[model samples]
Structures are given as structure tokens and as C-alpha cells.
Target: MHIAAQAYGRTSKTGLPTRELEATLLSQSAARLAAARDRRADDFALVVEALEENRKLWSLLVRASSAPESELPDALKQNVAKLGAFIFQKTIDLIENAEPEGFTALAEINRNIAAGLRGIPADA
Candidate 1:
């Protein structure tokens, strides 16, 4: 998928308070993945399936968060937060399991993701 190309345009069309929050989380995840790519773009490209799964999760978060009004709420916001955290943690676990020696990539990705998430506007 055109994940790298598409992620840069991420934003919320839905006025739902959680939409921007979701976009923020997804953008941060994408940035983390990008950091991994920077460290070993060729290596990650070899694990296309893992990368594809990451893209799928990101896409799901975007769509779910951006859904129209009347279908959104604070509970969904909490779920979004939970989901983002879960994804990041799971990614780290995967890295640890599959390439323990490559922990730097995992650590860097998590750090970048956290930083990006922190940058999101709270007024959403």
C-alpha cells in the first residue's frame, strides 16, 4: 500500500472530538514506522506482511475515528487510546520476538510514536 505516501495527508474530517485524536495517534504510529524504515528500510521491506498489518491497523483507526457524528463518543475515545497503545506495544513485542538484536529499531519507533502523539493538539 501507499502507506508512506498517504500518511502525510492524515487529518480529521469528522467533527467528533475523538477524530482528531485518532488521526494524531495514527500519524504518530506512521512516524514510528517511518523511523524503523530509516534504520533499515530494506529490512522492513522484506517483512511486507508485518508492514501490511501495521498499515491495516492504521487505516482502521483512521476510518473508525473519522466516522460521522451520532456514532461517536467518549467511550470510543478511550478505545482509540487503548488501541493505539496496544498497537505500539504489540509492535515492540513483535520486534523483540523476531529480532531481539534489533531492539534499537523498536525503541526508536516507540519513542518517535510517543513524541508524535504528544504533539497532537488537545483542543480536538
Candidate 2:
């Protein structure tokens, strides 16, 4: 079964979907659980920061996408590209400092964000 469908599916016995349960696991209440499972606080921070950076990059992408391609100044595009590169490098540096668990967390968050952005039209 698809992950989303499985996640939201109700158990045959209890007739309760796992969505709410899974939400709690990934929610703020799961901080301890995340820490226990990962066994490192630095990894958790990397995950959180990567998620945040993804959001910031998303905003930039949306703004640039809305602007007319012809009207978008070369300098503006260059600056955005440069900023993205800088952020990417910073993310790499952060991952390097983190342990394996932390690096995995960062990579997962970054991949999810990238996948989400890929679904949206670049020109939109």
C-alpha cells in the first residue's frame, strides 16, 4: 500500500487511522522520542535547521517564479543563485560537523523539501 494511504488508514480492529498517532510522533511531543532514537541533539538541530532553510529557499523560488522571465534582471537572478549556493555550502558544513545520525536527519529534511518544490511549476 502507498505510504500516505497506509498512514491515514484505519486499523480494522480499532477503526482509527494512524494519521493522528503518526502526527504525535513527529510533533513537538516527539522531541524526546527523536532524541532517544537518534541519540544525539546535534542531529536534531540539523534536521530543524534544514527544514527552516528549505522554507526560506521556497519563498525565494516562489517570488522569482512569479516575476516575468524577461523582466527578471540578470543581477537579481545572479544574487539569488549566489545566495542559494552559499546556503547549500553552509548546509554541507553543518552536516559535516554532525554525526551520522544528524547527517541523515539533515539529508531527509532537505530531500523532502526538494521533492515538494519539484512538484510546483517553476514558472508559477
Q: Kindly report which residue pairs in candidate 2 clash with one another.
A: none
Q: Which residue pairs collide in model 1, if any?
A: none
Question: TM-score per candidate, in order?
Answer: 0.34, 0.33
As a TM-score, model 2 comes out at 0.33
**In model 1, where do residues sit more than 4 Å from their true spots?**
1-45, 52-71, 99-124
TM-score of 1: 0.34
Poorest lDDT segment (10 consecutive residues) of candidate 2: 24-33
Candidate 2 segments exceeding 4 Å error? 1-70, 98-124
Q: List model 2 lDDT by residue over 1-124, tens digit each.
A: 4332343344455565433333322342224323433644535664554434443443444354346663657786665566456545545554455444543543444343333334533234
Q: Give per-residue CA lDDT, model 1, range 1-124, as digits (tens).
A: 4552344344344443444454454555455555555555357643444444564655565455556653558786666657556665656565555443333453344445444456744343
Model 1 clash count equals 0
Q: lDDT at 20 for candidate 2?
A: 39
Candidate number achieving the greatest lDDT relative to the actual structure? 1
